[model samples]
Target: MKIPFYRPYIGDEEIAEVISAIQSNWLSKGPKTVVFESEFAKSVGSEHGVGLNSCTAGLHLAQLALGIGPGDEVITTPYTFVATANTIIHCGAKPVFVDIDPKTCNIDADLIEQAITPRTKAIIPVHYGGYPCEMDRIQEIAQRYGLAIIEDAAHAVYTKYKDQPIGSIGNITCFSFYATKNLTTGEGGMITTADEELANRIRILSLHGMSRNAWTRYAAKGAWYYEVEQAGFKYNMTDIQAALGIIQLRKLEEMQMLRMQVARAYSEALADCEEIILPHDSHEHRHSWHLYPIRLEEDQLTISRNEMIDQLSEAGIGTSVHFIPVPKHPFYQEKGYRMEEYPETEKVFESVLSLPFFPGMTKEEVYYVADTVQSIISKHRR
Candidate 1:
């Protein structure tokens, strides 16, 4: 049996919502987007939500809304997608990299204070692989430093830090609805915040900095006259994507249960494998299980991670690495970032591989992948 890395669970409900949206004739950012923004915000216990084209846009807008600009530094983990750091560069701000906690693969809050300088304006903590970072301590640090917090929650839409939802904690939280995300709108994202003025600013910044969006400008009771408040980019979510988001939001809990089941099954099946280290789980925080990244104890095996990946592919099992560590990338390297600066991140990247994990994975498929992994390890045991 072949198991792909991920497959989104799109049901008839999503199809129906898309059909209804298309039939309405308003395909751009319209009523569906507005309703999606409201419902998603409410679900996450945030006061406001602004739908955008991608989570990258939300991150960029969050920095812009808080006036993070040239010479400003935003602290974030080197263990995440480059988009997390690229957004800071887009604003002409410097991205200061921090090493991750070896245990959680999230930013090490203990190291944050030492990285902060007078020019530091914000912290963008990423919830890696749906596991939340040490937010309480991060918040305390941010508070003491008077710094804004923009959560890179691309993998954490359903995550919670202690009793607080991920979206409700930070100054502005961004979520992705990409095709492979836990909750998908094909290619969309949302920004959530309790600050009303910040929400309004993000909304304006997402759609060309217009005083009013197309929905309001062309409505029967609206007028054509408007103002461009600031120079902004075109990053509005289309009605078609929001239509999918609306239905996806409704089915989120159900889909999450399936993902949890797959995660549980993997842990149980691989518990006896000495060469594999499972992902961390904590009762204190809810993990969204967006990616089931397992670290291979390479010292216990003769094969390298790349060799294991090749063996898995030959077995018809697909896998992927979570990230290459932002500092190791060519662009970041040219910008003076070095891998040695983030030892933990580089260590994790060498062994980490994301398994096939999605909402609708079959029990047989899960076991087959797990069994194949064990077989590979058995053959290569040192």
Candidate 2:
């Protein structure tokens, strides 16, 4: 009865797609990748999509496409995965940290203006735990400040804010298809934008800045010659990964329903507990429910977060923390990012823990996790 933290919702459909891709012989970025990109963009209400090896790669390319470079600054939340800020660093730009809203654990939109300076070029709002951020307010602030928005949508796929899909809202939106994501491609990502020029630039930069991809160059009606417009990284998504993506995209809605069921079940089971706080979702947004994070009320409990995690592990239940805040890491600390600067993130990081959540989880397993959490907290209650 060992429950892993995450298990991909893969089936025979995914296997068949991969086999079809392998049989096609053109396994690199090819027709399957193109179809996957198109379907994904359409699903998210975006005009264009560029597939990449990972969300980190998409973020990096977005910065590059937007002309963000050294001496520029990008504002983002401190309470997010390191990839959010690391991409800014990769673009040779400075990442300005902002505190989060204690309730949603998202970047506080109200605090964004104070962080904006002459050098500030963009805002990267991470949809923390598949919950949509305050996008409308963030967009208004960006518009007033003349800054671009690059959404860190690693935890957001089907997420929507005020009936608008996340991928279509930001100037550049990035999505991840990691093994743990709501919809997985094992390891893949997509960048979506409305601007045709920017989409083309991202495509070029994702595959060594080449004028043409391997598919086009080797096609019977295509030319063998191509040009290098600029130096770029090797970040193209393969046909095999795209094969998985296509299948996953087709079944996304069904998977999301199951995830919501898990969230609801947890809420129903633990509604009476005053020693723990559940994740929050705004009425205006549709949460993708990627990760179910709970906060232990330290004032009501004698045990720390680590002890709870250890107890869950001993009970054959796996759990994890969403993030440690970018500044808490040693590398960021050396770079002058202090935890004290982000009080909300610092506080949330200490109390938060992610429970086992995935589409593949059964009803009994969901209850097992909820019951286990309740039992552990009861024993530790003050």
Question: Between which residue pairs do clashes occur in model 1?
Answer: none
lDDT of 1: 0.94
**lDDT assessment of candidate 2:** 0.93
Per-residue lDDT tens digits for candidate 2, residues 49-82, read: 9999999999999999999999999999999889
lDDT of each: 0.94, 0.93
TM-score of 1: 0.99
Native-structure RMSD, model 1: 0.9
Worst 10 residues of 1 by lDDT: 212-221
- The alpha-carbon lDDT assigned to residue 263 of candidate 2 equals 89
The deviation in Å at residue 158 for candidate 1 is: 0.9
User: Best by lDDT, which number?
Assistant: 1
| Model 1 bad stretches (over 4 Å) | none
